[model samples]
Target: MQNQWLVAYTSPKTEKKIYGRLLELDIDAFLPLQKVTRQWSDRKKVVEVPLFPNYLFVKITQQERWKVLSQRGVIKFLSHGGVPCSVPENQVRAIKDLICEQEVEIYGSSSLCKGERVVIVKGPLMGFEGFLTEKKGKMRLVVRLSSISQSISIEICESHVEKIYG
Candidate 1:
């Protein structure tokens, strides 16, 4: 394959299951994960967990895509023209870098929901680099700091958040 990454859009919330299945099926797959440690209000506890909830990256030959499609939790490859599309290597590498540096732990769906990058302006959280998400009928701007891999998401009002690059 000319590309190293393919997007595996799995059944919702079945990301981990698919990751394990892919490995079991001997497919070189990676479900990009961010370790997060969240504590309950009355507890001094934390847990490491994944950031992206339902996506995984797979390294497969074009010929082996059918094998991937046969996996139980896999839905379909991200595609165009009815042919599976390869995810850009740099994008996959960026995900790897985030995982390697542990930068992804604090970053959540809201942080990178609008493609891969964004610029932030307005609010007390100004100058904080982050991403946006449209959820529950609102636009959320989130900044995830590595301190706890904890993200602060606020419903964005009238603000200046623009994509610098995608």
Candidate 2:
């Protein structure tokens, strides 16, 4: 059976634990982590924390879906119409890429929910298209992908995009 990338909702603060379990079960799993420094009373330490709190991604086939859900700390697969949905490969890659980025921001669903559809006409992200939303003096290209039911925003220059005809 073919496997597809899917998102799973996990118990609070158990993202890493679930990821490890999947690995033990020979299931392909990914938990994007970001480096953050925390300050204690007398010391500071750098730690890798889950980028998306309480969420984990796994590559599994339909027959293996139930196995993932049965893992401890795993709540359920993010689904629609009672069917588990697979996240687009490109969206998965974007999240993976963002984890290595030194500066990035994750916004709520409302922030980029509406705007004009635009395509990047220049720069490294040339040909990228999404809803363009301007915030805090910065222009962001927000791409909303189904399956995950989440939108990711990438910083872009206002001059690099032009409107697209339907």
Candidate 3:
């Protein structure tokens, strides 16, 4: 009974439904949600939405994938090289760790500005931390993943960033 993470794609806005079904079947699942503050015609509100729309994580055996495959609202697992993709348990664990301890925040701002104090985890850049700065006259936000002395810039906020801070 080895544990594996599979990417489950669902119909638009069906993430919650898929999550519930997985839970009912006693499957472990994860969905990273982002907290956003939005303004409506009459008021402001804080909303939590999926970071990756139409996706959810399910922990199951390869033999059990077909059961989930037939579940309502499910599209299928992601694939590469023409094979179904299986996410690593460690990767899922790390994302869960971030969900537990991350403080990065993102909000609507003036046409793509810089942020401050980003903490990085994972990759050759593991344990990397730095401040974010904008490239001259560009709307893209860059985070100096290392530091000022000798560092490189990586584009964030427009990519698959797990989290952002205030």
Candidate 4:
């Protein structure tokens, strides 16, 4: 079977470690991270933290699924009704492109109600598709990563995106 992107749930705080292991084993993986300024009692430091906690995306064929599961930190692939869920390539590409911008926010998939489907037609996010939402009186584009029940929202200009009509 051809390789497909699957979401791997990992042990808490082990995302980076498991990602490294996947890399060492020559398995293709993606772990989205964002740089944030963390405050400590003594000092402040900027660190790169996983955008989606406890989740990593792996590209593998059906036969390779077991190999991924054999890794120490991996719990299992995200699934529905005992069947592994594969993520669309376009969504993955949209995420990679979305992270290049600085104002992204992560949200639990359940928190936001579905809104209008839209595709960015201008600016850096051109061609990225997501739902249009309004929060705190500002419009944002929300990209839902359904396999893992998480979504990422980025504030966007209304002119930058157009509604996707049926």
Model 3, range 1-166, lDDT digits (tens) per residue? 6867778888998888788888888888888776779999999999987766887888888788887889899987877766767765555664565455543333444533465555555443344464556555332323341111123344433223333455
Structure candidate 4, residue pairs in collision: none
Candidate 4 least-lDDT 10 residues = 104-113
Off by over 4 Å in 4: 102-119, 123-139, 163-166
lDDT of 1 at 84: 67
RMSD to the hidden true structure, all candidates: 9.9, 5.7, 9.4, 5.7
Q: Write the per-residue lDDT of candidate 1 for residues 52-131, one digit (tens) a residue.
A: 55567788888888888888888887767777667656545544644564111223334345434566564344445667
Error of 1 at 126 (Å): 22
- Full-model lDDT, candidate 4: 0.81
lDDT of 2 by residue, 1-166 (tens): 9889989999999999889889999999999887779999999999998867888999989999899989889999888898777887766776775555544332444323337788767654456578877678565678665557666667654566677877
lDDT of 4 at 144: 63
Error at 34, model 3, angstroms = 1.5
Q: What tens-digit string does per-residue lDDT give for candidate 4 at 29-132?
A: 99999888999999999999998999999999999998889999899999999999998887777677667865443243443334878887865557767996
Worst 10 residues of 1 by lDDT: 102-111
Positional deviation of residue 93's Cα in model 2 after best superposition, in angstroms: 2.1
Best by lDDT: 4
TM-score of 3: 0.64
Model 2 lDDT-worst window of ten: 104-113
